[model samples]
Target: MLAVHFDKPGGPENLYLKEVPKPSPREGEVLLKVAASALNRADLLQRQGQYDAPPGASSILGLEASGYVAELGPGCQGHWKPGDSAMALLPGGGQAQYVTVPEGLLMPIPVGLTLTQAAAIPEAWLTAFQLLHFSGNVQAGDSVLIHAGSSGVGTAAIQLTRMAGAIPLVTAGSQHKLQMAEKLGAAAGFNYKEDDFSEATLKFTRGAGVNLILDCIGGSYWEKNVNCLALDGHWVLYGLMGGATISGPLLWKLLFKRGSLITTLLRPRDKKYKQMLVKAFTEQVLPHFSTEDPQRLLPVLDRVYPITEIQEAHVYMETNRNVGKIVLNLSQ
Candidate 1:
């Protein structure tokens, strides 16, 4: 099997394709012939040596993949059979011709979606669903703000929030991205690079502020995010793209508003926890994709690159120019 490997943790230049032993399924697992894999910010961090794969997991760069089940190991017989189309959220090792995954992590490809589109769903959609419903506790008619609105998770969050009957507001760096967010069901969007998003959000919600906020930029947007929330609002932090330290006085405002600040990460969680999330998303969200209306829960893909152009893909992602997921077609 050919897999993406790095000589050292540094730059995309270090990534190379090499022949490696194909992985075999263990108990409760299945071996998949990977058709496509998607890119994420975590992949960039891992390549730069800022993040490490969880203990006992593969060191490969990918976090999610879509493919066909080639074999099922012991204890996994009834769950899925060989030749079944599936997608999975993996801890790592998705950037290869094949990967072994826990059967519980595999999701049947939604009806009418191609393998490449399925490949783009797991990580972004699952993360968005978990953050909005579980952590943020978003309810119908609630006002929610999503930062980085044109990103993979952002695009998913916009659609999910709207579907849940919440008012979805967003922030992006460009007018084009803002438009894209609105088209995906965001009530409104702000150009974060050129506008005071906090003020804009307040105006959009008529000064009541939003009930929840999904944030990826950390310190730089911390104070603003706190100010943009309604009383008893929830602010969920999933990334620290703009540094991690907060330097201003924010405790008083939070106390006055009875706000809650929560931080979370998905990659390092135990298998049991991930299985719980997968089950919840599979039951609640997957059905939307399988319905007769195939467009209902489609993933937004920015671009698809062949496996051989892995370096170029990384370069494109690092530029922060994409409005949605960037996929790698393994079979290409």
Candidate 2:
């Protein structure tokens, strides 16, 4: 099995393809012959030694993949079989040609989507679903603000927010990215590098502020995010790309508005919790992908790179040049 490995994490240069033993399925798991894998910020952080895979998880870089079920482990019968086309949300080890995943994390490739496209779905879509529906409890007609709106999770969040009947307000660094967000169903988009996103959000919602905010930029956008929330609004934090330390007064505003600040990390969660999320998303959102509608939900792919070009893919991602997911075609 050829897998991406690193000796000591520092940069993308550390990553190299090496021949390693293929992983086998354990109880309640399935072995997938990986067809494709997607890149995420977490993968970059892991490569640089900033993030570590959870205990007992594979040290491989990828978090999600699309593949065919090569074999099923004991206690994993009746749901899947050999040769089944599936995508999975993995804790780690997706960068390899073969990955063992829990059965619950596997989703059949939806109709109208190729395996390569499905490869981009699991991590971004599931994270967006969890943030908007499970954590934020966003309801129809709610105004939700999403920062980094052109990111993988950001693009998914925009589509999911619209699908749930909420108005999505997005913030991106460029006009082109903002336009992409709007094309994906965001009600309004703000260029955060040039404009105050908080003020723009408030104006978009007619000075009422938004019902929820999904933010990845941490300290730099903290105060503004707090100010952009409506009374009893929910603010969900999933990443801290802009540093973690926050200063300034916030307790008073939080108290005055009865706001809730929630933070989550998906990789460290137990299997049962991930199982629940997978089930919920499959039932609630997967149907939309196959539905006969003009606004069908789908994974947005920014670019595809062969496994040999993984380093270049990382470089492109670091430049923030992608409007959606950057995928690696492992089978290429």
Candidate 3:
């Protein structure tokens, strides 16, 4: 099987196309003929050796893929067979022609979506859904502020927030991205490069602040989030794109104001929590992507590169030049 592999992670240049041995189904896993895989910020961190795959997990460089079932391992049952079209969010190993995932992790793809487009769903959509509903506790009529609104996660957040009857406020560096968010149901957009999102957020909420904030910019946007939240609002952080330290007694201030803060990672979640997330996502949201109804949920794909061009894909992401998701099309 031809797959992208890296010996020692550093830059995108480290990725190369090589014919590795094909994997066989394990006791509880099933093999998939991979059709496509999508990029994520976590992939960038992994390529830098800052992140490590789990114990016994694949050292591959992808998180989400769409594919068809090749064969099921023993003890697996209930409606799956060879050539069944599916998509999965695996522990790793998405950048390949074939990979195995636990049977329960796979979800049937909607009929209208190509394998290339279906590859974009799993990680971004799951992250957005978990933050807004599971952790942030967002509800209908609530106001939520999301950072990096042009990002893949941002694109998903805007759409999901609107679905729950919440108004989404977004921030990005460019007007083009802001317009993209607007088209996806963001009620308010801010330019963090030139505008003060804290002030703008206050104005948008009539000085009441927002009920929840989903942030990844960390130190660069942390203090601003503190200034922009409604009383008792939930503030969640999942990444630190900026510096990670604080110089003052910020915890005491937050305690005084009765605000809540949480930082979470998806990889460390218990199996049940992850399964719950995947199940809920499949039930409440995944059905919207059927061929009959035409409810497409993919973010704008700025570029799609073959598995051999992994190096170039990394360069594009590192340059911060893309507006939405950039994917690796393995199906072709």
Assess each prediction's global lDDT (C-alpha) against the native.
0.93, 0.93, 0.85
244 Cα displacement, candidate 2 (Å): 0.5
lDDT of 1 by residue, 1-332 (tens): 99999978898999989999999889999999999999999999999999999998999889999999999988885979999999999999999999999999999998889999999999999999989988999999999999999999999999999889999999999999999999999999999889999999999988999999999998899889988899999999999999989887878888888999988888898999899999999998898886586448779999999999999999999999999999999985
Per-residue lDDT tens digits of candidate 2, residues 39-86? 999999999999999999999999999989999999986799999999
| Candidate 2 segments whose C-alpha is farther than 4 A from its true place | none
Q: Give each model's clash number.
A: 0, 0, 1
User: Can you write out model 3's per-residue Cα lDDT over 181-246, one digit (the tens) per residue?
Assistant: 998889989998899999999998989999999998888777788888888999989888976887
Q: Candidate 2, after superposition: displacement of residue 6 in Å? A: 0.9
Which clashing pairs does model 1 show?
none
Better of 1 and 3 by TM-score: 1
lDDT of 3 at 232: 94
- Clashes counted in candidate 2 amount to 0
